[model samples]
Target: MQQSPVDGLDLVFYNVPHAEAPAELTFAIPSMKAYCGSEIVAHTLHNLYTLRGAKVRDTLKWVGYLDQALDHTQDTEIFFAQHHWPVWGNKNIQKFITVQRDSYKFIHDQTVRMINAGMNGAEIAEAIKFPETLDQELSIHGYYGTLKHNARAVYQYYMGWFDANPANLDSLPPTQVAKEYVELAGGENAMIKLAQKAYTQANYRWAAELLKHVLNYNPNNKQAKDLQIKTFSQLGYMAEASTWRNFYLTGAMELETGAPRKGVSTEMLLEMLEHTPIERFLESMAASLNADRAKDVDMVINLVFSDLNESYQISVKNSVMHFKAVPKAENVHTTLTLTKPFFLKMVTGQSGALDLMFSKETKIDGSRLDLRRFFSLIDKAPGTFPIVTRK
Candidate 1:
């Protein structure tokens, strides 16, 4: 609407439907978010990736609104998305919006088609590339998101979180698997040497690929360190996702110099915690636990937040931690009474909820040493990670 006068065409910000439009093309992101301002449509597209697609597992129904985003696909000569830009001409805009809205729709629809046809998300994503004409566009690139991930999300939208494989239901996690991979690959040094050879052979991609697995298990190995540096350089030199480029570059930097995680904002964490599923919070805590060191230690801490009127009983028995919310009926160990913001900090180790022990902010009836030991039990997953392969 703020264009510098296009042939004296009325610069009307048309909120009218495509059925009413007599314009070139209509562009939108389907929705909007931070970073990309209004007028440009953007979807975070993370949940788009996680749920359904991987070969290992599938996801269940996505409870979010899909139609609310897609229904605005009418009345446009061209539609410009916020992340990229707009495509022009009535035919083009209609096709573009239809393609995109239908892209999510197709993945959702055709996936059920394929799922009924006996294919999974991984199988479907591999088979579901858009036509060459659409795929050629750089804006449709898999910089931040990929077809594979999106397809899986659609699968999750219907089937729920499961890969239909029992082994994966209770299988070893990524880090544990990575550790075993390192052992089988004749240790980190051997893999690093292999990665170096690949890098030297101008196979920067393969080198980066092999090196990440080595680093995942032994993040501090000198050879793994050096190879990853080269890999980041290669990725940074070629990446289109500024965020992806930054993730690779920053991860490389952190490997050389162990950068401690600066805590996520307390307000944001509290907002997330207050409404997030208790299971998800426990999963977050499980991700927080240092599985390598989590052994025979067993303990539990009960916390009560007066403001929210909630109580949680967390038991760390046999190194596995369990957290559940309930009424504070019987006192167990520690009763940390604090605001949600302080509790978020306590979980992340940025600040303490147990500071009541010293600050006189609240009351506590648990062992001080037990509280400290409990804090030591969990591991923190990183906010971002490097992509080993480009797809």
Candidate 2:
């Protein structure tokens, strides 16, 4: 029985094909491909909001599922994965499963071994190598997930961003450091010349790095910006991984023009958020609170959703927001009662402070000024920001 919700609801279903029955056909969802790298690796290596980094242990378990299927389906004449073409013949199927299983295990075990030897993520990434048995096989080649980045991901999974170097414990921000670097390199012109030299040598990575420092120091430097765009294009063309290529090319595009104004539609966003639990939205609001603005304020507001019959207590103290789902607090400075639809409308900006203050359906039981103060502490984000250029 699957423990979690298959499609947002708990389900119980019998597994077809008893263990003892001969299996001429078998199907398996490749969880290893989802977590590890498949035909294309997802751009989740350093994204903190998602899974953060690949969970090596979970990856192994996914491959183990495939291995288990292989054991049960020894007589299976055909095997197929959800995303790939089917494999025929039992021996061919066995080889395919074994190769994939070993590939994931190899990455996990080898990365951990390097971690124990006092090598940091970058160093481990540079030194790790695949054996000929795995290297020669096209099935495990890094068309999607390169060995270099995946090894670094494994390091990130265990050690995090810190490399134990005291000098890097609290380094300056990138822009500040970039300014210092440009000044040390004898100004922007000299940096551009150096970057030009690297670019001429087809050392696009080094050229991009140098140009990045130049651009960071003075985003208006036309010479540096043009060269950087060229460097990004070259790097993008050279990248084997589609994700890396897309990122590099997109960086160039953003630098040439600007970030695209269009994004996910508001209606689509609202629909997605509607299905999400209310606590998650509250958490997002807490994260969006401006700590500096809220430091001097302390407030507790009770939120009552009539449609859901739910009450939550939200408190801000010492520049931190805390939430709890319970009955309304008697000591709360204010209580606002409304339906879930109205609350969501407020969240998505379909409604605003004026709407909240004047809406006929919304009931305000305490000081409206305190409610306004609470809303003021939360900062509004534009949803997109400059990536390759400074604000």
Candidate 3:
């Protein structure tokens, strides 16, 4: 079972042979397709840019689905969705689908036109305004994905990440830039004074921006930190979009509670590894490598997942890690053979690598010292890193 796209309720699909259907009855709909009786209502303004996170959705593709839904469901009497009450009559269903469908189409088409006219993401996000009729429609309201974010996502999808500006191409990382800003603004006390004034003026955005620099410079600044919590709380309360509200309120809660207390558990890590493609998992490890620690290290290790019947070689060179899914190479620093579960446990800190080697859960050949050195260079990342405050 999976939730319908817009209404956010469970839908269950059942299989039926073609011979069982009446000549007039069909399951296929052009864009908004479904199986059996599980019809999806394009009732709500579906997430054009989902905040909880996923690939940026193609609003045009979604509109195409709606077009198909209109052609297929014309004769249907009742229109039901996951979250909201069903529309009982044919006319009402048509009205609901037509308005919702057109709203998405308008947004998609207008954003594309703006992009072709040489508008950037932020410009497009601010420029596109909904038609008065659609804007006033209760069904297609911005209760989830708002116009501001959806427009930006559309622009990014078409134009890519570069804003066609050279300044953004090689910008300093956030912490470095924040430190510079703090120094330029005459240190913590000066920033705190400015932020406190902004807070008083109800300019929460500026206050949060300034205080962030202060907090990044000194994570222990109680006054700056407390003001940020207040700013996030106010922003959370004022937000109409559910996702925006959740993000702000959650940030406040994290500040109050000292970040999320949970780390990736062994079971969770194992489940993730079990489902992930081996090549993708290896590629991800490059991102997780502690480059500073591994700067001078150059080694290669053969990994054999015996139970899964997979073999790969991992190479570390010039502070970068690379992997290929080929037969294990003979010349290597170490060769470790283990089941996928055992590997997950060892990596997630649930089981000691040396203990696993001794227990025969992991069979290691070649230099044990090389394996130890390699593991030492791997940084132990905290599960819950601070966001609003310094780590």
Candidate 4:
């Protein structure tokens, strides 16, 4: 769609309909390559699988967007993206889009091909590699999304989480495995000694790995924690990608000083709540429920948002929370009415139940005890929860 607000300028929009991918809406000027952030880029490979976690992107739909941009902007002279500088000249623009498109397609196709050929995720990741001609290009280098992770992402996208290995199907959890490893390796002191040796040899990767095992087994091990801090710092300094470098450095900082006790900002809380669906929010609440604490507790709470004109009925049964958009007011233990602003304040720690009740911001229509019990079942993660160090 092209919209001209002025006499001689038109902004054209290009995005895949009903699909989640980068540069949800990109603008294009006539005879200029569209500025597609992740859809099409000039330099540095876009994250096919985002580092911070998101929905799996549709590679086919992403490629389709690139094709649409190409067909519609045939007279383009140069292109630019949010992540990097511009690529000038028609030949270079064509080549950039072509390479970017093919890179994603190759990863998706080859991963599926290997899957059909009986190769699992690890094997496919090890086997897949871009041709030398493409890999040598500075534009699509593994600065963000490494080939290994993207390959694994593709496999997981197509074939779900289970790898069909019976042994892996019922393996012990991380803490259990860590305890076993510590015992088998002669305890925390012995593990720390080995990690120190690895650190001395500049094998920071192995050092970090070993330290994680120790921390999991005995979180109070000061030696293990200090060594992990050093190893992560070294790893951060050596990383090329900004995201990778930042994460590593942050991990080290948290290990040394603990996670910050900063609360969510008003702007951030609003943004998150605005984009998140009601169903997803309820699902997250369900996930965060303290099952052991709520084993014998059951309650129904009807939440009515006055500002948004929306209502949801939440029911807890078997220590799991279930919610629906339409109100099921019947048999409800309590019905709480509050505006979006008040709800935001309460959730972000700016206000509490007492403030809401005292200020009449949130009106409680039924048993306050039921609401109190429901709230107590939701575990409150400490503001400065551990990250690099064990919890």
Candidate 5:
């Protein structure tokens, strides 16, 4: 929880009573909200690594570990995080983390238990809440992340993928649904006016939900777009979790335009990726390529990243893909040699296509023209559009 300089976050918005009214705006929350990026991202990577096995190399000694547990006997315990006030004593830190761990673990465990008892995911989220004492506790709070969403994540872990609903099987996409909702709830202008009222009354959460529909219905509606941005601004200003603030701001940016990829620092993700299946990563890579370039140019490119100890010969036939992770030195389009992290960096677009050309990091020798052509076929991973439905 030690805060870094990158941890500082803030969001600001105007305080108009309604879209029709003009009024002064100010900082929604009057405090500095900060957190450690390395810490949060490391934890996230670990969770994913543990939940779904990842692939890492023995030669590469480090993954994403940011901190080491200080010897309790030598280093005195007086603080927790850099931004927040601290408490002394190892007993205190132990007590603090005990409740923190139990809170998330409780929601996770109990929600799964309830799912086994036939309560759906949403039901468990509604019925479950952290103990009142824990609710009052600052560190274990919904300000950064919520118990509600996490509970649903737990239910999804144990239960079947769907909520057992036939209606959801063929439901319209969010944008389509939002358009219908806006028409039913009056109109674009009406929703904007109402959202402004909710925002002004310090009812940010509701404002967010309503304005989201408005923006989705009319993405170019500046009034609705501005209102949605302001809503996320307020939420970001109020958030204690740096991750939450980043997500909100990212969402706001996407609302103004279509989704854009903000590639993460690949160093850490690459380290954790070793535990991932070679075929899955290649599949994801194939999915990442720009398919339009290869619409009429279907071909196969076998890629072998030696340092990752992985091999995948990717074939694109009739727009259907087949990735096999077997050793083959056949007449292929490309034979690349690089470490896991750098190759992944290239795959995620964090590094440029020619950086490898100018640098000593990686090499691409065979059929360079067709290799580029084959790499052009895949698509990137979709946005915060739920990997699995929780909304």
Candidate 6:
């Protein structure tokens, strides 16, 4: 019999700890302490782009964990975290964790309170304020995540992008709106003069907005672009949060010069895709499908992964693609049998339909034309589209 990876190793797995009782461990060290923080009680909430925005419920859960730690580690002399410095002395540790926990709760409860009062994300962001108890604490200050943005994030987590305004529900795109705004402001020159006045008054935010409208209406307007770049630089310098600073600076860079040619390497991308399930790839492909092109066509393709011994039936109808992992469909317009690696290559553009048809590693059965048609309907995104300016 073969021994598994942990066959001879001692290990302990436990369920999540509750506020009433926490999972405890002992270590031979001078200071008897606990490491209570993880993603929750960092110096600030470093909210990155996950599938969904960061949730206040998660923050509240961390507060519960902190409560458990406080209850269980009464004699603990030190406390540490995943990021930043550690706290020493039981009294100081207690104060630190208590403030950190309350700060999140404050943001969450207050945002909800304002939301219930009929205020939208932007309104709540500007209106919400922290009590002096949490506000005066340096540990919970917005170094990575601002209270303003987090307030809005909490709003988005609850209410989504819509702010309950009927006019905003179906507004024109930014370019068209900019054209209207610029014309209303008299002309491009008038817009620039207003932006210059705002910049002179050190109101970079308003200046940036006006310049954005001018540039959106005419991207090649050199004067507007230059002023916008300067405005972005000022905003970047003024930002307290590192994320906001980086975003503003990056926007300035992209506007002044073109977007950088560099991006994630193909090898790195393929490695990431390798770990992702085939269902997600199919979903992404469906999302990228050109609906206009596929509206008049209907096709079905059977994909067989010979190495993985998995097969899926994919059907396109009414400009939408539906996929299922089942026995190969008898009515499939095309059947392609290939290894997972070859399939990855095809999806990533390293291999085309001709390669699939001709390669010794793949076997194709049924209509080649249908297979080609399927690939053609999937739009290929340009890797480096402009961000701060018109493409």
User: What TM-score does prediction 6 earn?
Assistant: 0.85
Worst 10 residues of 3 by lDDT: 17-26
- Per-residue alpha-carbon lDDT of candidate 5 for residues 21-81, written as tens digits (9 for 90 to 100): 1222222111332122112211111121121222211111111111111222123344334
Off by over 4 Å in 3: 1-43, 52-54, 78-90, 116-119, 175-201, 261-273
Which one wins on lDDT?
4
lDDT of each model, Cα atoms only?
A: 0.58, 0.73, 0.74, 0.76, 0.57, 0.76
**Model 1: residues with Cα > 4 Å off, grouped in runs:** 1-47, 50-93, 105-129, 136-139, 148-202, 210-228, 241-244, 251-302, 312-326, 331-336, 339-354, 365-391
Task: Assess candidate 1 and give its TM-score to the true structure.
Answer: 0.54
Error of 3 at 230 (Å): 2.0
* Worst 10-residue lDDT window, candidate 6: 19-28
Model 2 Cα shift for residue 135 (angstroms): 2.8
TM-score of each: 0.54, 0.83, 0.78, 0.85, 0.57, 0.85
> How well is each residue in 213-254 modelled by candidate 3, as lDDT tens digits?
888788878888788899988888888778888988888887
Per-residue accuracy of model 4 over 18-75 as CA lDDT, tens digit each = 3345446766776344444433454766665677888666777777776776665566
- In model 5, the Cα lDDT at residue 283 comes to 66
RMSD in Å for all candidates: 9.5, 6.5, 6.9, 3.2, 13.8, 5.0
Q: For residues 161-189, could you state the per-residue lDDT of candidate 1 as single tens digits?
A: 67787875888766777788779879887
Least lDDT summed over 10 consecutive residues: which range in candidate 5?
58-67
* 1-391 per-residue lDDT for model 6 (tens digits): 1212334543222233322123422221223344445444556644422223333334455556656555544666765655787777878877876887677677778888999999998888899888887788888777787788878767886888898899999999989999999999999999999999999999998999999889889989999988988999999898887878888988989888878786544655998878878889889889999999999988899999898888999889999988999987788899988888988888777888779889998988999889889889999775677778764
Q: Residue 225, candidate 2: how far off, in angstroms?
A: 1.0
Order the candidates by TM-score, highest first.
6, 4, 2, 3, 5, 1
